[model samples]
Target: MLRTLTRQSPLFTSSVRGFKTSAAAFVKAGDSVPSLTLHENSPGNTVDLAEETKTGKYVIIGVPGAYSPACSASHVPGYISRGGELAAKGVDGVFVVAVNDSFVTKAWGAELTQGKDSKVPVRFIADHAGDFATKWDVLFDASKFFGNKRSKRYAAVVENGKVQNAWIEPDSTGLDVSTAEKVVGQL
Candidate 1:
């Protein structure tokens, strides 16, 4: 009787079993960056990534979160220190994206550009709802560590609204594949 009931249950139906769906494919070379508005300080002050990259060569660096050890120490600093060199290589902008609120993102940017007298060109923007990363298929299930969805570590070089190149880390949390140095080298 138990076996029969289990088989008859709606939850155990074949339709339910076959309901699994694959995630969207990650962004690739030649794909246009999604038109998503990310926040710089608050929702009022927004940065439209697709619009920003429409006419320029830009690098988008995605991180799990702001103030995280890997991000604060090595990941972001790598780009921060090499901003000039990257610009010299013809990269017009370098954007750092995180799945945090705008306030945290702004504060973090302030900390990174403390003594530069506003010369640092890196724009640290907030993907408040993790929407931008999700659209690019770079959102990772970071519930265990971040308590919510977070972006995978990756970088994409975009030119005139399309991706020129993409470097995504094998492991979402790993630091090797998508570091600024490596991406810049590839550029």
Candidate 2:
């Protein structure tokens, strides 16, 4: 069969016209962390990740939700349990960030830290509006599993407000990469 020319043909496409389509760049090594105001414990308490990372080495962990199964079971707990080792390796703090409200984050943080002898400070921060996740390029649509947008599971090693290294979950919310053991050992 012979094909006829059509307006929808690939040859008659925007790409062939040389129009460029661009997507926002994801946060990676050498990228400067943005200065987005976040909250810890309460709205009154503000956490500035950029400023916190400026003085020393820090790990910023992004999660999909505050009390989800994976996040509650292993992800955040790994970082909390290994906080001492992280501190010994010169890590100043571990910030657990989620796109939940301050109340949820505060309660989760307290529960996770209860009776744990973590040496480094592990602070659970609320990215209530997902602005931080968007800036980091890790925000995703999780309306199917979650109610709204959620952050991809990720870990970024920041030094002096610049990313030294980073790991983003290939599946958006997978458990393979960005584990505390994997990231901390490298640091």
Candidate with top lDDT is 2
Tens digit per residue, CA lDDT, model 2, 1-187:
1255556577655655577878857789999888989998899998888887888899999999989998999999999989888988999989999999999999999998899988998989999999999998899999999999999999999998999999999898888789999998899
Candidate 1, residues 67-109, lDDT tens digits: the string is: 9999999998888888877887888888899999999999998
Residue pairs in candidate 2 whose N, alpha carbon or C atoms collide under 3 angstroms: none
Model 2 TM-score is 0.87
Worst 10 residues of 1 by lDDT: 112-121
Off by over 4 Å in 2: 1-24
